[model samples]
Target: MEQVQQRLTELGFSTGGVDGGYGRKTVEAVQAFQATYQLEITGQVDESTWGMLFGSHEGQDIAADDPADAPTADRLVELCLHQVNDRYVLGTQADHNNPDEDEFDCAELISWACARLGVEFPSYSVSQIDASHHAGLGLSVSDAATTRGALLFRRAGHNGSKYNHVAISLGTGEETIEAMDSKHGVAVGEIGHRFTDGGYIPGIQYH
Candidate 1:
């Protein structure tokens, strides 16, 4: 565990001094690393995470130049909008885990898009405070007036409630395509106009 903690720190995730202690900081660092590498954010160093961390001799390549993990933003957005009217189900379906299911939620919708585009993304809702959530995925956009294919996130604590949401930009003025809710399975609407705690994360590919 010390070796793993050391490797994590060397990979740019600080494990709070790494004294062979798998404390909260260590877990958070591991989760951050997993988020960056598009791995399962289990917070525990699983076999897959361990392999990636120690397998690379030189260093982990967290850039898009690694052709094996490149994401095409245009293709992702195109695919996301293609399934605009699927079913919306909570806690099930619509991720790499269940690719065949038609039902989806907000986070699931984004994950489905990533799968179709051959890109890696967390299938669950990603928190804004979570570092590395968008690492290597693309650039970060701060403006509401963003380009097409931009990934949007709704931070927690809206209207005095902790509810997070995600959606894909449709480039239709200010509209976005998302698996909104049970009532609106999947549809396009003015997400920016409705949500105040929203921001844009640029797509992996520009063209």
Candidate 2:
């Protein structure tokens, strides 16, 4: 627990003490950290929190006001891009595939990145990207300027209401970072016209 507390402190969380217990102070500290990062105020150190402490996603912000502790956004972006060369799997947790190494899918990837950057973000469904009222902020998945760290959306057809696919904006204007599938792993692909929806949390930039 001392190690955990120390790690949390290094990640900018004020753990109050290096004690190995999750006491009220610890919970409050966790809640404070979560609130700052726009994460659900669960007051618990879940996988997402652990990922943040471990530096998996260094450039994305989980906290609205916290500036990235990372020296440069380019480093964070490069770290995320490096994972693109990895393999992808559906519905798998980021820590499961290789406990020895950190890898992720779309949702997990974004979540992990944001946590590390101390940015707050919400869990989202691929289909929710196109909903008239998204649970979070919305952006144009098809627009290049709006696609940076934005969620990519895809419809079954031109008139489909449900988004069947999702990806992360990689800032190429026409390409994005995606965890394709177990067979494909992770990679960058050109934006397809089939995708029509894009959304991202406002006031929360990925730099």
Candidate 3:
């Protein structure tokens, strides 16, 4: 069931995330698939739906079970929001290159979010590029940062050469949740300015 949900999400059908559970989102994904393939619009996974979905991935092996603590997309967003006022500490975690939530760095926040989902993400701002290579981790969002749980990235300094920063989407207009340096700490702020005029270039990762 988890594999099925994961497949639906990977195929861009948006089952919300592979938690092996059924809800309105899963039903909607099933209905959408049925409608797309001209299958009976039952909104239930029948034999035909299973066969088709399974057959489509003939060469791949679906996992027999999911990790007990793998966080879903919604949960990832919730966890990020839970740390709204965390102070920006430099070495809260032992590894400065790959810090955790308590470290309060931009990349560490993203890493912590992915870690909750059982996906490993480098906790350094510069090394965040590694996220693009993993499957079932998350999808890179180039334009749609408004989607909740999306991880937003911005290159910092003049001409974006100095460093990079990352944040989590609040899905509320152009706002984002992030630990914005020493003075601001962690809070929600307008993200649109980050991409306009001389601001940073915006990129996102959907967990």
Candidate 2 runs further than 4 Å off: 1-76, 96-102, 122-124, 127-136, 144-146, 155-163
Sort the candidates on lDDT, descending order: 1, 3, 2
TM-score of each: 0.54, 0.50, 0.50
Candidate whose TM-score is highest? 1
| Model 3 vs. true fold: TM | 0.50
When sorted by TM-score, best at the front, the candidate numbers are: 1, 2, 3
1-207: candidate 2 lDDT, tens digit per residue:
677677656655456689799875466555444433434456687877656555566335533243446423333333344454354555656642342234455566655555555654444444345342355566665553344566666655555634356666655565565665565455555675646667663323455
lDDT of each: 0.60, 0.53, 0.55
Error of 3 at 37 (Å): 34
Runs with alpha carbons beyond 4 Å of true place in candidate 3: 1-70, 91-101, 133-142, 158-161, 195-207
- Please give, for residues 1-207, the per-residue lDDT of candidate 3 as tens digits: 898887676654556567888876576666545533435656699998887677864323221133345454444554554454456665344243442334476766667667666666677755554354233234334333556656566656735535567776654446566666776555555666463111111232333
Best by lDDT: 1
- lDDT of model 2, residue 159: 57
